[model samples]
Target: MPVITFANTKGGAGKTTAVLLLATELARMGHRVTVLDADPQLWISRWSEMSGEMRNLSVISHVTMASMETHIRENRSNTDCFIIDLPGTKSPLLTMALGISDHVLIPVQGSAMDARGASEVLEHIELLNRKMGMKIDHSVVLTRVNAMISTRSMLLVKALLAEKNVRVLNTPIAERAAFRDIFDCGGTLEALDCQKVSNVEKAMENVRNFAYEVLRLMPVRVVRSDRDGKFLGRKAA
Candidate 1:
């Protein structure tokens, strides 16, 4: 299994929503997923409480720097993937999480060029690489994207990422009512009412594409036992 952390030094970068989407989508694909709710806000924790026993999914709330490794070590055997949702603001926890993560995803709003928070995360990663020779894999995910048109701000952000030579995900998370509604409703995108929410099918499709791109970056191998057809993700070699 691989540990993927979603982090941003600034708030409202759409980090939590991306984490939820990836965790839920991976679980839906039959991989056992554990989400560490490292954020103080407990958004994912509250959502998990409301979800009530989803198959192949688990959530550990109130995770801290002290307990994060313990939780991962304890759950490694059962988890196919571990997704950590770090705090919105800069924290010592960010460095600790980034140090251990197989991949760190920094979510930047596609509509705005306010990548200051993302820059902070990038700087930390660079410091780790320079000071400790730790080459941590990471990518910028353009979130809250407008599906209709590519705005000027978004293009500038893309250019800035290119100038820095940072990898960006091919799929951008689009702005959709369903994405917001899932936090309020406390379930997967599939669980959303298609009739009530506009463009739910499109939202689901966008999530699928985003998840697929992530899987390409840090693939998890899953297999089924002969005795029980349940899928089990093999530990990363």
Candidate 2:
């Protein structure tokens, strides 16, 4: 089972936006993606209610630390990918989610606060690896990047992340209005009217790249079948 967990200790790191982008894109690709909305804020849940019906996509709200694994076990039959959206603040739920995740994505901005928040999560992941040998794979994704140009400051930060031996995604999420309007409009990037939203096509391309990298980076493992609960190939292209 490939479960991807998105976590950032600091709010405003664009974590929720990235989660929605990946979830919708995966569903669009014909994968049965189930989003477990663990965040009390329920942004994804609200969006799901508004999205009406998305093919191969479902959202389960009010997820708790106690019922998280239960939901996974029960849905193991139908879910192709489980995406968990954690709260911005660190809590016991964070550790619980990380324990069951196949991969962790940390959204970092070119700011001290975002970096600090990401670092905290990384340390926890490292701790789990060192102590329990969990071997949780993780990467840092730069968010809200300037689309027109990559500033030298951003490059400096990227270099710093590299020096720390952190894996950074080649694709940085651009600061686009389409990403913002999706929350209000209650649909996906494809549903947005390109004529109205600036760079909607560009945003779609960015999301495609982001999702491609995500699928490439996720581990290929045999998991329970959606129908029979037997081992099956989920990484098939």
Alpha-carbon RMSD, candidate 2: 3.7
Could you give candidate 2's per-residue lDDT for residues 1-237 as a string of tens digits?
589999989988988899999998877776678999999999999998988888778999999999999999999888888999999998999998989998999998888788889988999999999999998989999999998887776777788889999999999898999999999898899899888889899999999999889888877533324543333456443
Output the number of the lDDT-best candidate.
1
Q: Please give the RMSD to the true structure for each candidate, in Å.
A: 2.2, 3.7
Off by over 4 Å in 2: 221-237
Candidate 1 minimal-lDDT segment of 10 residues: 220-229
lDDT of 1 at 206: 94
Model 1 clash pairs? Answer: 1-235, 1-236
Q: Candidate 1, residues 51-162: lDDT per residue as tens digits?
A: 8998879999999999999999999988888999998888899999999999999999853434888999999999999999999999999998899989888999999999
What residue pairs are clashing in model 2?
A: 77-226
Best by TM-score: 1
Assess the local accuracy of residue 21 in candidate 2 as a C-alpha lDDT between 0 and 100: 95
**Model 1 segments more than 4 A misplaced:** 111-113, 223-229, 232-237
The residue-level lDDT of candidate 2 at 163 comes to 90
Work out the TM-score per prediction.
0.94, 0.92
